[model samples]
Target: MIGAGMGAMAAAARLAVAGRRVTVYERTETHGGALRRHERDGFGFDTGPGLLHLPAVWRDLFVKTGREPLEERVAMAQVEPAVRHVFADGSSVALPGGSRAGTVEALDAALGPGAGERWSELLVRAREVWDATRRPLLEEPLTGAVDRAALGRDPYPARRRGLLRRRPATLTGVARAELRDPRLVALLESHALAHGLDPRRAPASAVVLAYLEHTFGTWYVRGGMRALADAVYERCLERGVEFRFGTAVSRVVVEGGRAVGVELADGTREAADAVVWGAGGPVPAAGDAGEAGGGTGAAAGRLTVLLALRGRRPEGTAHRTVVHTAGPGGTTRTVTVLRPGDPALVPDGEHESAVLSVAVPPHRAGAGRPADRAEAMDWTAGEWAAVDWTAPGAAERCADEALAVADAAGLGLGGRLLWREVRTPADTERETGAPGGAVPAPVLAGADGAFLRAANRTATAGLYRVGGWAHPGGGTAHAGMSGAMAAGLIVEGDDWRGSR
Candidate 1:
């Protein structure tokens, strides 16, 4: 494995169990890729995803690879009232976990009469889309020639009585036609936006994203999401997988158009029968992968603010609160305040740890650069570690803006400041090796298959791609699923159907 990311580690553990001598070479001296943790003054914070959804994806991996299930290794609990949405209209809605009816009731109570019914109806359609595409798009490895007609056809049903000539094909369309209320529309769009997607352009299949979270429920690891990564890493170690941290892979060593090994930064080469691109570090020039062109555009970046407060989290506070900031037309700017259900995140009972994550647009497009994906920012290795977030007080200013938005949304943070730390896209790029520090969005079914990701089976016979940048696309669960598919392809050969 080229990198020890979540997907790479998942595949490594399975391959190790399958009797393959798996070795992971990570540039960083850590196991988890984006599932990172930061600690200061006894306060720990997850720099990556705050929570996990559709945890069955990981549970299945643990059960298949070992006797002990995932829960045995890491503590996890469902977050009740999963997320509180504070819309632009000043009204808020706290939606309960894992209950469609409860969500409907909450929506109706907050939005208005019949609002619940509209959302419930939308869920019915979303469930249908989920059932249709969950198999081919997710469970199986994408083929060289994807069935554009099948996957492109949006599964979300259109309203019968909508003021339109035909059914809406995009998420924004569905929100406008079915959810007339702007608050409901904002709620629906927030799901896509949270995943670094533009709801206006995202296909209706994106509805599945919302359905998955609401239906399966959001969960928090006992310590942090990083704990889950630690558990997976431990499982891999038990399976005898060798991990070489602080090792940088310069390129995949290819011979006769097939990846035969990887060349390390130190000029040493280790040969392998197969190579997996687990940590999509840098795009190799053509390689044997036939130019590697089909991959989706550059990804959006996450801007997170970490807060260390002197006060305690008040009783009965929502675990997660989203305060939608006012922005230009069609732009979704949300400041998600995450108060982990796990108390271990805080320094003590009196202190609190709150994280604010804002999905910011990518840097402006450079001259001659594709407008869709921009790699305008220039960064070098080790720059992220010494990033001057305090230069001109940008970090503090951003934190104040987030806090102000939160206060406007009825969640006040007045006079509770101790200090704050900010992580930008440049930091993400340096840490994860993602191009342009862009965080890729999960692949969705849409017209022209525009949302399709690069095939796991590249042109190179032995080289394969996995992780958020690969087929089935981004999101924690999807990344893990990509690993399962990659391992299945390697173990079962090209004819492998998938893991049932």
Candidate 2:
């Protein structure tokens, strides 16, 4: 394994249990890739994902790898009123978790009569899309030649309106045609944006993203999401998987048209029969062999602000809140505020820790230059200077914008905040080695398969891909599934379809 990310570690554990000696070489001194935690004083915050959806992925991992189940490894519970949405129009609604009827009732009560029914009807269609693609997209590993022609077609059953037989093809189109209300549209679009997707370009099948959360329910593990990462790392150790941290793999050693080992950054070569490329960016020796043919489209990264507050967390507070604001050019922007009531996160009962996050364009050298100047610059300029996140307080400014939105939604953190830490895409890049900190979005079927990640089985024989950068794409659940699929392909042969 090339990295000790959640997906890589998951694969390492399983492969070890299958009687294969597994070794992971991580560039950083940590195990989790993006699943990192930040601490100050006695306060800790999850800088990566704040919540876990579709935990069955991890449950299956534990069940298969050991006698102990996932629940025994970590403390987790469903977040009630899964999310509270505060729209720009000053209307708010708290949707109950895992209960379709409850969600409908809450929407009707808050957004007026019939609104809940409309939302429920859309979810019904989302279920259809999920059922159609769940197997091919999530459970099975993508073949060398993916059936793009079939999978490229949107599975979302958009209802036809008027005399014309036209149906919405994109997520934004569905929001306008079916959702109707602006607030409802914002609600739907927020899900896409949160996953680094643009609703205008995302396929209608992306509705399944919301469906998965609603059906599986949102959950938070005690001591932040990093605890889940720690559990997986511990599992790998228990399975006899070896991990070498602070070590980078410079290239995969290829011979006779097959990947036989990896060359370390220190000029040391480690031989192996098979290699799993789970790190971000690019596979060293694959030569674009595993890249998605049509590309996965433009991806965005996250800007997170960790706030330490002096006041006690109010009782009955929703675990998550999404504050929607109108962006430039009529676009909608959202900042998600997370205030888990876990005691392990705060210094004491009198203090609280919260996380605020928003999606932004991935970092690029000179990408932040003034638009007019950028248009005038030479196309082949040499080594443009790196984006100065600190100059003029760029990260702080972005965090302020997000905090303002959250405050306007009634969070009122300004008066209680003790200190704040801003994390930008540059920080993410430094930590995970993902270029520009571009977080990969989950693979969706549509737009001629433009959003799909590369297949697990690469053109280089004996070299496989796992993690968010590969098929099935990002999200904790998807990453775990990627590991299982890669393990199955290696142990059971390429003929293995998936779990039956």
Query: Which sections of candidate 1 miss by over 4 Å?
Result: 161-165, 281-298, 330-332, 363-396
For residues 127-184, write the lDDT of model 1, one tens digit per residue. Answer: 9988988888889888855465578777777656646546687788889888888888
**Please, what are the lDDT tens digits per residue for candidate 2 over residues 292-370?**
3213246777889999999899988889999887764455778899999789988899999999988765666555631
Clash count list over all predictions: 0, 0
Model 2 segments more than 4 A misplaced? 286-296, 369-391
Looking at candidate 2, the ten consecutive residues that score lowest on lDDT are 373-382
Score candidate 1 by TM-score against the native: 0.92
Total clashes for model 1: 0
